[model samples]
Target: MVSLSLGELISSHRSRRNLSLSDLAEMSGVSKSTLSSIESGETKRPSYTTWKKIADAMDIAPSTIINAFVDTTYHPKTLEIVLAEVIREGWEALVAKVAIRYLESPRIDTFRALDHIDGTARDTENKRIKRILCDSIITFTRSRGIPSYLASALYERYLIERDDFSRFEETYRRGKELLLYTEHLYTEDRIDYYYKMGVHANILGLHDESIELCRLGLREDRTDSKQKASAYISLFNSCVYFGDIHVAAIYLKEYENSQYADFRKNHFRATLLAKKGQHEEAIELFRVCLQEAKKEGRISIVVDLMASYLEAGKTDELLRLIESEDQFLPEATPQHPYRMKTLAQYYRRKALCLISLEKFDQGFHSLSESIKYFKQLGTTSEVIDGIRLFLRHHRTNNKNLSFKNMEILEDICDNII
Candidate 1:
């Protein structure tokens, strides 16, 4: 199990084939300088694409080159470095192949490494890198003949990356088809797929469908406790979204008894309390959950908590929470899914606060800003929701709204909602 340096391995392979560096470079379609650097150990970590090309030129498996860079126990950071190099070189397909082989290594922390890479790619704020990582994972999972659950997870990730309901619907439909008819997927994969489908359904506002899918997942007698816990949470969230608090409460209790109960339980408890008009208690619980979400770097959950604050009519508290934050409405970038909807919601909440405080002009301005972001998001449902919010709040507090603002709200709702 001698761990030869990558350069030494390359040189040995080239000499065994009696090919000069230039000959290898020509065959591999890589620059001679890059190849030289790799063989001289100057490039300690060559891209997966580069290694694959060289391996192909030398008529050897790409894993041979990958193995040259690691011994029996390699740190996860080493994998991240290689993945970053592969992504930078735009060698998604090659990296997929390499990743599949790497997963077979007994010493590798497969899921942890994959999850770390996924999170890193997400936080990178580079659209190209995110796209490459998505493509690589999809290709790797699908081609490696691994469990279909991995492929389904990657598809879900891509759906989030795309951030379009239409694409999500299409992907979910396709996943359903595969889960129902494909022989390659195991029961466990099917359960995982169903659970994810249920969660995404809730995200897309298909509450009933989400509940059904989650129930279907839970019905699987072979499902492990962890999977069952996930299904229960999905069911609870879906029920909560559909305004069935009693049913949601039942699931919440079950979830609390499950092994995964922790921060998520408190988050759900806060949601239930808020729904029941217990704002003060909900706010306290939300603050705790928000702190934990921040520590976990779960931006979406933080946004959810902010929305909850607004729903609880704790505008002053929400404003105070966001006043000193710099990344509250993180600069929208092409690499990451646009946070237009989240930003729009934030502005709408601000408008509500202003209106409640009798600041009509500032409130109108905030409303207008929210509408602008909603229009940019270009989703019919979101626009309709925005319009509905404006109309509902105006109707409930017409005495406080100026005639001009009322007219504007009427026009917007008449045209959209």
Candidate 2:
């Protein structure tokens, strides 16, 4: 594959759109001369950021531009990393298409490449990749259209985050209808759907729903102990969320009976123990998770452990996490939405920590960036309690939080002003 000549590539798209030099410059924030220089080959090495802005403004992904620029590889060099460009930019569809194309490639990691943390982008392209995976699995079941159950679940979550109860309830009802009556689902197929449904519920703080889906999947799953163990893990996690140690213990026992005691499962088991007054055991489990996370270079897991430390008031472990070299991938790369996303998570956590320490002014800056993250995902209300509680406990002068409770946070929750 020959790289597209800068002139040919830019000219094709620009002329195709009847866009003028100034028009492209305004759209991409590149100066006209630089744009001209690049097109005329006077500028051979444009910066990734500048080139990326041009690609994004043209509504083309880096991979597509790169494909035409350089030889296309059997393995994907870049995957489309979609972030909300404007307040109204609708990426649900763009993302859907990207996954379809990515999955078509046989050499794609298929799992690791799609592993994204929520609220930020990553060079690994994980979150969008996760969404793509879920969407693709369902597409495998539903055949390439939007899955209503997922759409409804996501919309309901979106509404809940915004405190839009009236419509949220309505969407939840609608989503359930689509989910239950979903046609063309094979019994073997529904197991993973149930797992994904549980994940969606978990994201919305709906522990019961997650537990229920996990149970459903477990009940129906026959072929794989791995899936059964996963469902049990979900149930155990839900129990932990509601502080039901009795059930959590039972699930842990069952997990022990089964052969699924990997570090990943053990990590959650540790958090459960740590939070349930078994500090020594919990800390040990956390250390295990920390080691595994470090070994695998899973920053997301590291962040989770760090968050657990923060919640557990384990200052030492939390600080260690803060100093990580991969403090969320801030380097400018063609794989952007994946880049700054980790930085977003890093900052969000830092802000929460700052707020917890009563550093109100600095806390707000970090928190504000954190909020920008949720806002991008159409998420706001879900994190309000955390934000408000942080503000309540730490706000030096505002002192708006009445107690570290949901009621006050819910009342105070509003989009950024």
Candidate 3:
């Protein structure tokens, strides 16, 4: 059944009964103005006695209306479903339509919807709706005049889905600014916000900031076991990135001791093992991690596991792994927010595998493709890292195949730098 606003549902039932607002008011003993206010959504939460009177007048169950409001407030999926229905019904009331759009398209679609709403002149019927819609959209899009807890949640989602680091940084700054002014964040919300901020900082190579954020999350008195585990993991990763393997190992042990150990913990352990030069064990663990991630349809984790393979210098094994998995093609576009970064890594690994097999021309071609993606992402860091990996491998194994290609690689690196 379609979910409707309390007012809309009440109005529909009253219309079906062929009763005017005045007639309903007369029967329910509610004033005509009160009935009109409720019907127009100007009064959302009526007194229970008033609601019961209205329900009695309409000859429907009061519980149904209560449940509808509860579901809309607490269940996001229910709200999304209701929004889909509202959109399908072509509700032209600006506030309802804007709410529908917000639920339907939290990201890009809502931006376009806001633009449309702004361009259209406000009518008398829509003035109130427009004000509410504009406030909500501004809170989300501009990250201003919004509650800190809500702004943090929205920004976290946006940051996680954004591919461009610059854009992600902008959103992060705005979220941080909003959060600074927020005074009433619940413990859970604060923990979640700090965790997301830590992860984002780690991704942007701000290891110290990430470590601090994770520590802050861990220090919260009311953090749950799951949140503590997550904070520990984040701290471990940040330390690892900062080249403090010992400290990372300590946090990793804490994470392992937590009740939340899972495939993620295993994956991090594999990374640590690889960093410690335990290639055989690390490769085995990564293999298991990849299988589990693939089973869960977490393709991003699978791709990341392949990077671990590269780090472990398992080029032949990585190539074999790629060939065995139909989903592990070098040319396919990844669905992750870090699509270009992942793609670059994939091609870089593929090139290293090909180079180790004495296929200079094909390997260089792959390397060039990796460079192209890195260029598109406005970063030469990955390309430089890939080049260094290639140089290290060439010095060890492929020295006889390519002094000429080494010159080309050096030239490419020089130009980019």
Candidate 4:
């Protein structure tokens, strides 16, 4: 599904009704500030009363917003962009076509199209022309179901660079299917396809699927322990997502002793500890991971381990590291481990941290951001409950919004083509 960003969904609904945020806020008994935050995904969890009021005010079944929030992986942003594009282009048929494709193909086809770029260099090597021709031929073959594994592989890479994983799982599905149907398509071609998908699934909160796919590679491919171990570690990470700490422990143990482990085991081990409520120990473990990864010259791994250290509340270590200012740090920091699931959780936790630090606005901002991503990702039901409560407490004044506006908006959304 084309996930609509939180901003897009709320704005579209507001715009079509010709209702201002202030107007809606007034009618729903929601505070303007709170409504803005909820609309923006900042206040990650709205209280029960808050959402009920917004639902009641908007005349939308509280269930529509509630269900939208619970669907966890709903395509809110996708819907937003398509809606906006339709509005811009005045192509109602195109909008309809996209919606149909969205519901039908949903994942793979969308990623392929979104990630498709041309006249770009995959590598700057001696066979530049060959890579270009290969990408072209691959794209063409995959389009017609000709088992062009290379094309699918290239498309997967494109998705990674762009960070557009709305259809991540779908691409993995299509790529895997093609590989299965055409054994000849199995070259050691797209290790990243497997690895990145594992990462994306972890981010999106599909931990089981993530680990399972990694296992598919570890068992099926000729990768050595190094590669296999990462895949295994990925599976270990998923155990946390599914909320089975003991299972995570079992997998963490496996990863810790793996011949494939390259000091990165420290971070993974620490992650398991943190999840198991051994937070203090986990913090120390990740500190060692940071040092070891730095020692091993694994830039990406070091960045990752550092993030884990930061997340697990290894505060003193973070402070000391900050004071020391490792001049050799990467240009950018790594994101939280899951990057997929629990985005709102990240914001919620961050907000708590900010609150503890007495940074009220910053804390609120963090929570609001969390709320937004949660809305985007369709957070857990517990989160939706909170959002609803927050909204009901809000006292917006716009009591009557016309369905005519919403209809106009949907028509505009349908014109994205």
Candidate 5:
């Protein structure tokens, strides 16, 4: 597509705004002589600060002011020149929209462009705007599965939100690395990081680390309901994981009036019931939760309900639940992280059910499949757990099974890791 020159863009916007060179100079704080030089094509590459002042004076994005100079392929160059300006002028939201639009172009290396913008804005003084812009770029990168350090942190958050514990240990470590890049993280992002890392730590059996992380999130000020909800949920779960039911209950009560109280409250209440040995009540609550989650089409919760049922020894019911969901095809979209996670857990649950029913061969094959899925999913922790689970069941059920098959399953699990 043919594009206007930077000089033409600036002159056109200035004319449309009905501002003379002197008037523009007065509004933008740029000398009329320099404005004339830019508009007349004498100053071909005005500094970012100058372009920003003019864009601000014209009530336009710096990108709009210089769009003529930025083709789809040169979009990052535009960002590199003005990201700091965009942040300093509190135009993060506007510029982020522009950047996202540029990302939609198929010819661009969008991830590399975002990375470039990040690097260019590294020294920008406004932390709040920097944080906002950082979140935008990282969020885009994460949703597209583009690998970058910040995007990886958000990906871990995504995994935790989906209740995928397959990589909890690695997630915790990566979250620590994420902390080192905190200069550009907003308060909400920090809260999200702490709570998510806290959950991962809790899953890794690092109770103290989890508690500290949750406390850090709670200590952040000006948190809204959703943010506070996350912190509270993290604290409650951490306490429960540590067997501090009293503390967990206290945290739970603290959020009883939350907007999320119904689903969140009931889910944890069921957990508390299970912990208190009220199996039937817990199972009933989970069944209700399962129905609600299904009605809402909450796949993560559905998968979680399957795990809860299996934990409660409702094997047949769990199998039936899995079978009933046509949407639970884990192998359908391997590129989708949530589906892949669900697939791993789905097969793992199926294997456990088969083993319990003394379907030894089918159970071993399913276990092998689960381990393979977890390995392909790059979750070392899940792979190890799968191996240990196989070993435990194999030891118990070996006499009733073919020795060669067991050996093959062991080799399959071992070879993948």
Candidate 6:
């Protein structure tokens, strides 16, 4: 038998019984406004008691009404089924169409659906889908005034994905303009926006801004344990980058004391040790964190652990870590901006190790490959870091460098930076 939406079923049954909404409101003792909302699909999931009252007034079983109303609407199960299908099938045109339709609904499920669709679109480099999803979100938000946080979240992410920081800075200004109005946001959305935007700001090297946003999130009294933990972690990262080591240590300690402490704590501890000039202890902890992160499928942190080894001046260990991680490395596609940055860093570290070992030709080529990946990202800070790496090496190895090699390095730096 065909299924119907809650609204459709209610409207059809009421019509067959020749009951106006006024009559139903009087018979069911539910308010006319509420009854109208139910029939119009504005109130998708009224409480069981409400549904029961309406069902009893119509001389029907609540179970029959509930079962018959299960259809492809804004129910949680419908969202789950659509997400599962999208995951199973890969993002096809049909899936994209259905995803857009589902995302246009003004519900929490619609927010979740948009997140899933946006993730797949980013992975697959589906810019069209991303734009469409953003438009759909804008339309829904304008119409409903709910899920407002998604506009900032998705727009910031889209800008970050393309490494378009010029536009991002403008967006950031607009975001700051909205900060005073954030009291209108749902608590969960407020916390989530702060956490995400804080992390994004940190990644983009806006450490002060990152710290400010994360602190705002932490100040929200209604934040849950997970939300608070996330805020603390973001604060810790920003403090570390902002060179406020004392504050970073405090945040780390707070996270360690929290119930959410896990392998991530080891990673943060390793970072702290590295900052304090305790390279040996940091390296050991990094090794443990790398293993655990790999087991947990945290690819991003695994790359970071590799960088930690490089930063500690353990070139030999860094090389070995790269080789060992070859099998597990995700494909570094130009389409995937974050992966491109990761590979750029990976290759840059490998090039440094090779150069330190006197493998000139291979090292130069590896460095070139690293620069190529960084160029695709349209980012300059990382490219400047690569140039600094060359300069530092050249200073120490001046005698080892052939005059021709020095010219090549200068040319690379001048051309890029």
lDDT (tens digit, per residue) of candidate 2 on 365-387: 66655555544433346356447
- The clash numbers for all candidates, in the given order, read 1, 12, 0, 62, 0, 0
| Model 4 quality (TM-score) | 0.43
Q: Per-prediction TM-score, please?
A: 0.47, 0.47, 0.48, 0.43, 0.51, 0.51
Model 5 global lDDT (CA atoms, 0 to 1): 0.65
Q: Which candidate number maximizes TM-score?
A: 5
lDDT of 3 by residue, 190-263 (tens): 67777777766665556788888787777774534776776786688778777789999899888888777777
TM-score of 2: 0.47
Q: In angstroms, give how far residue 13 of model 2 lies from its true place.
A: 30
What is the C-alpha lDDT profile of model 6 across 1-417, one tens digit per residue? 344665776688788999988898899899999988988878877765677688889887544554443333455546445544443544444344445556655565656765665565455444444545455454555466654545544443444433453233344554554465466667766676676667656655678888888888777755347757766877887788767889999999988888876678988888888788777887788777767765323445556666667676667676776667554465445444444565777678678778878886677677867766665554566667776676667677764667766776566566453
Candidate 4 vs candidate 5: which has greater TM-score?
5
RMSD of each: 13.3, 15.7, 14.4, 21.8, 13.5, 15.0
- lDDT (CA) for every model shown? 0.64, 0.56, 0.61, 0.52, 0.65, 0.64
| Worst lDDT 10-window in candidate 6 | 161-170
> Model 1: per-residue lDDT, tens digit, 1-417?
345776787788888989898998899999999999988878876765677788788887544555555432244555656656655665555455434444445566656556654565566555555655555555555666545445544544544544543344455555564454324446776566677777666655577988888887777745347767777777887787778999999999988888767678888888888888787787788777766754323344455666667776667677786564453455442222124455666677677777777776777778777776665544447667766766676677764667877676666555342
**TM-score of model 5 relative to the true fold?**
0.51
Error (Å) of candidate 4 at residue 316 is 12
CA lDDT of 229 in candidate 6?
78
Candidate 1: where is the Cα deviation over 4 Å?
Answer: 1-166, 173-184, 221-230, 291-315, 322-344, 355-379, 387-417
| Model 4, residue 9: C-alpha shift (Å) | 46
Error in Å for residue 278 of model 6: 1.8
- Using lDDT as the yardstick, the better of models 2 and 5 is 5
Candidate 3 regions exceeding 4 Å error are: 1-166, 182-184, 225-230, 257-260, 291-315, 325-344, 352-417
